[model samples]
Target: MSEPQYKRILLKISGEALAGEASRGLDFGVIGEVCEVIKECTQMGVQVGIVVGGGNFWRGVKDGAGRMERTRADHMGMMATTLNCLALADVLEQMGVEVRVQTAIEMRAIAEPYIRSRAIRHLEKGRVVIFGCGTGNPFFSTDTAAVLRAAEIDADIILLAKNIDGVYSADPNKDPNAVKYDFISYDDVLAQHLQVMDFTATSLSMDNKIPVLLFALKDPKNILRAVMGEQIGTIVKEEK
Candidate 1:
């Protein structure tokens, strides 16, 4: 087997990825499959750090109660992310992989609080670190957290596991003729205002020169393929 392309990588998995078919909540089958892929990547010597989203359980903007402030709603969302992270860490541990859940917000009873140096040390020790709570602040999405963690850890790439296979000119689900690029420049993505990721995350990755690999998470093995540098999905980076 060939050496993996990335020595260290940060994987960004949306909460929706954990929801297999249901409209809400997690599907353990999907989580188990994903864990299997992560185990394979770890066995190949790829240092992996994951950041999970919370859309499956809650979305701050979707609540109509009007009782909670926006910041409070967002904090609830962050807690939801921690739940997903804990579940994922449990599954990975069952698969015999050493895993750690580090939350930005302190939840000592459940997991370790986020400490940049400590998280880095965990990765260096070959343990998969899962980051939750979206920078420990409201209004920032998990996508931004992925980029922040990637920069903090000096990661080679950001593996964006999404529902779609790659970034398209338009929403492929809505447009039949949407064009998908095998590779794209960050400037092009920004110019097109593509929804591959939020502006903050995109700009940070671009500035740091960390390529973002956008691929579908449905195919669990794609995670391993991406770390191996297989041409399986769209890759966004600086134009050379």
Candidate 2:
């Protein structure tokens, strides 16, 4: 087996990945497979932290949030993320991987509040820390949360898992001829306005000098491969 290049990583995946082929909601089978993949990494002595998206259940921007207040809609989305985090954390625990779910909004009954030092300590103890909710505030994307967590935990890299395999000049799904890049700079990503992540998230990553690996999550073992430095996706970094 190839050795892992990274000691610790923050994996940011959309809720859609957990949904599998379904339009919405969690897919137990798919998530179970994900849990096993993550378990493989922990055994390799890699510390893992994760940020789950809420797209499968709710998105604050959906319907322009329609009639609801912006903050309320955003709160709903944050709650949805907590649901995903809880589900993922439960599965990881079942797989014998020590897991801790931290919520930004302080849901003491279900999860511990997001404390940077505590989360880092968990990772140091070989526990996977699952971050839910978006920085305990409205309007911040989970993408931003992922970057923030990576910075706080001093992670080596951020695995930005998506439905597609890598970063492209245009939407790969819609534009067949769109060019894919094996590597791209964070500055270039921002300048081109690539939708790889929200601007706040991308900027945060750039400023912190965190390497962001954009890859497909459909393959169950991609996470392990990524940590092993398999070059299975596009790597984004700061050139300067």
Candidate 3:
């Protein structure tokens, strides 16, 4: 097997991926498979930090639009992410993989508070650190939180494991003719208004000079393949 291309990575997973075809709740079968891949990455000695989204349970901006206060709705979304993280941590532990869940919003009984040095230390010790809660604030997204955590930990790259295989000119599910990009620049993504990460997340990654790899999570082994530098996804980075 080829050695891993990156020594450390920040993996961003959407909660909808965990929901599988149901797209609204936890699916242990999918979760198990994902954790299996995560375990393989760790066994390869690649340090990983994860940031998970909560779209399956709640979407603050969409669900709460005009129905409730934005702050209240966003807070619910944060909680949803924490729930997802706990689930991942549980499954990882069952697989004999040491895992730690750190929340942006403090929850002493359930998980540790977000601490950069501690998170890095956990990764160094071979523990998978799952970051929950979306930047501990309203309006900001899990995408931005992922970039924030990646920059904090000095990760070599961000692995975005999503339902879609890669970046498309348009939503592939909606537009059959949408073209897939094997590689793209962060500036092009922003200028074209592509649906990769939100503007904030993309800008943050560009500013930090961190590359992001977007690939489908359908085959959990793709995670391992990505670390092995397989050209199986759309890579977003600076051109020069």
Candidate 4:
């Protein structure tokens, strides 16, 4: 019931997370849990904008490895994101949360085209805005799109909901000795070549001075805990 540390946040969710244990397609149960947490954030008067990934359906680089042109493959990946946005929007709406979906690519039949001012207006009006398609360009990951949207909206912070608990010195799954960081500087992340995010996304966040809080999405309440300013994850920002 306390005031959240941030007034507005950009939440980046992995599509594979949405797929739950099946790891292949939409899992409404997991989506429902995530959406329930999102609803709670709205009830707390927090404005939310989301960028959901499309790895569950298609991974441009991995799936398009052989013969598909990179551009076409990425476009397919973008469409996959639209599927996720629509799925999230549907669930949120069913929960009585006003939702709007904006896509980087224009699809008049389904969603509004990405307009910076309009997207901000939607947030201000207490509507959840879901951004789909990765920057409307090929070769750019959804991570970059999330940061780009966060910067455009002037969000206080980005809540990155992933499978891992936080950033590790190395892949914790692969390396037992990998150390977890409660907080880290953007420069260190870059210098050490850590995979907190893709290089472009991390550099963009650093330049924009937008901090990213990375946490496991398994316990969705961690999203609320993060907004309440609890130290539950690895925070990446410029070191003062």
Candidate 5:
């Protein structure tokens, strides 16, 4: 078997991706397929870390956080992320993948607290580390949390699995003339205001000089392709 392209990677999966075609909540079919793909990545000797969003369950910033106390709403969103991570971890373990969940917040009963050294140790043991609960702070998106975790773990790159195949000049679903970009720079992304991820997340990635690959989560094989460094999606980087 050929060697994998990256030694370690952080996969940022949105809660919406876990929901698949459904309007909301977990989608077992998608979960199974995603786990299968992750299992394949493990076989290739790649240390994987996952950061899941809570959009399906809740979105503090875009949701009713406007009316509610910002901190409380964000805390609720964090709990929602923990729920998603636990479900994913359970499915992954059932699929024969050794998985450990770590949350930014202190949730001793359900998961271990986010310990940088411990997380790296788990990855070294060939275990998948699932990061939940965002950054343990309000007014922060899970995308930023993913990058923060990636920086902490020193991951080689971030795999941003989204609903679309890649970044576009405009929202493809909304615009007919939108064009797809095979690769884009972080500066252009900000200058053009392309909606790939939150500004905070993109800025963090740029500050750390980490690359992010954006791809559709529809086909499970795409996960393997992205991890294997295949040309599957748009690569967001600091340079052209």
Candidate 6:
């Protein structure tokens, strides 16, 4: 098979991906599996940058305790991402892949603050950098952070490793016959109000002309396949 078209890619993984069938918290086995795939991609000469979400541990809007403010909940969510970042970094390191965790929020002792130049340098040295914290602020999702980081790092494409295999006209789980799009334009996504990512993230990617490939994370090999340009999922890009 021919290699993937991308030389550099940003992979956005939801915190939920780190969880096994349990539906909450970190699962080392799952993380280790993902790390192996990442190691393979790195070995294949593909530069990889990752942005991880904190939904497994926290979601600001979903908190029902009433005592927690939105910003406070979001802050906790950011910290949760740091924990996931550290875990991923450790696992990837054990896999013999150079990895770094950069946070949007200042957690000096645990990670380096998000610096575009430093991230770029790490990528140049063939190190995988995982970005944690959601834009270092509330009112933003990690999806937006992924797009921002991709643009900052000058990534060729954004790989959205989702729970589902690809973008669909409707929620496939709800509607069995929902059509899966093989390829789509960013505009089409926006126009159709598809939920591949949040509108903010989708708009940013469109504005920056970054293509996003959505694929399932259930198959660890999908990561390698994505980097190898296997066309395993929907590709969202600008229209020709």
Give per-residue CA lDDT, model 4, range 1-240, as digits (tens): 579999999999998999999888999999999899999999999999999999999999889989799999999999999999999999999999999999999998999999999999999999999999979999999999999999999999999999989999999989999999999999999999999899999999999999999999999889999989999989999896
Worst 10 contiguous positions by lDDT, candidate 5 = 57-66
Weakest 10 consecutive residues of candidate 3 by summed lDDT: 167-176
User: What are the root-mean-square deviations of the candidates from the true structure over C-alphas?
Assistant: 1.2, 1.2, 0.8, 0.7, 1.0, 1.3
Off by over 4 Å in 6: 64-67
As for model 4, its CA RMSD to the true structure in angstroms is 0.7
Q: Between the candidate structures 5 and 6, which one is better when assessed by TM-score?
A: 5
If scored against the real structure, what TM-score would every candidate get? 0.97, 0.97, 0.98, 0.99, 0.97, 0.96
Candidate 2 wrongly placed segments (more than 4 Å): none
Q: Model 3 over residues 1-240: C-alpha lDDT tens digits?
A: 789999999999999999999999999999999999999999999999999999999999999999999999999999999999999999999999999999999999999999999999999999999999979999999999999999999999999999989999998889999999999999999999998999999999999999999999999999999999999889999995
Candidate 2 collision pairs: none
How far off is residue 142 in model 1, in Å? 0.6
Q: Name the lDDT value of residue 157 in candidate 2.
A: 98
Better of 2 and 4 by lDDT: 4
Those runs of model 3 whose alpha carbons end farther than 4 Å from true positions after fitting are none
Candidate 1, lDDT over the whole model: 0.92
Q: What is candidate 6's lDDT per residue for 1-240, written digit by digit as tens?
A: 567678899999998988878768999999999999999888877899999988788877676248787888888888888888999999999989998889998888989988999999999899999999979988898999999999999999999998899999999889999999999999999999999999999999999999999999999899888887787999999986
What lDDT would candidate 5 get against the real structure? Answer: 0.92
In the predicted model 4, the residue pairs found to clash are none
Candidates 4 and 5, the one with greater TM-score:
4
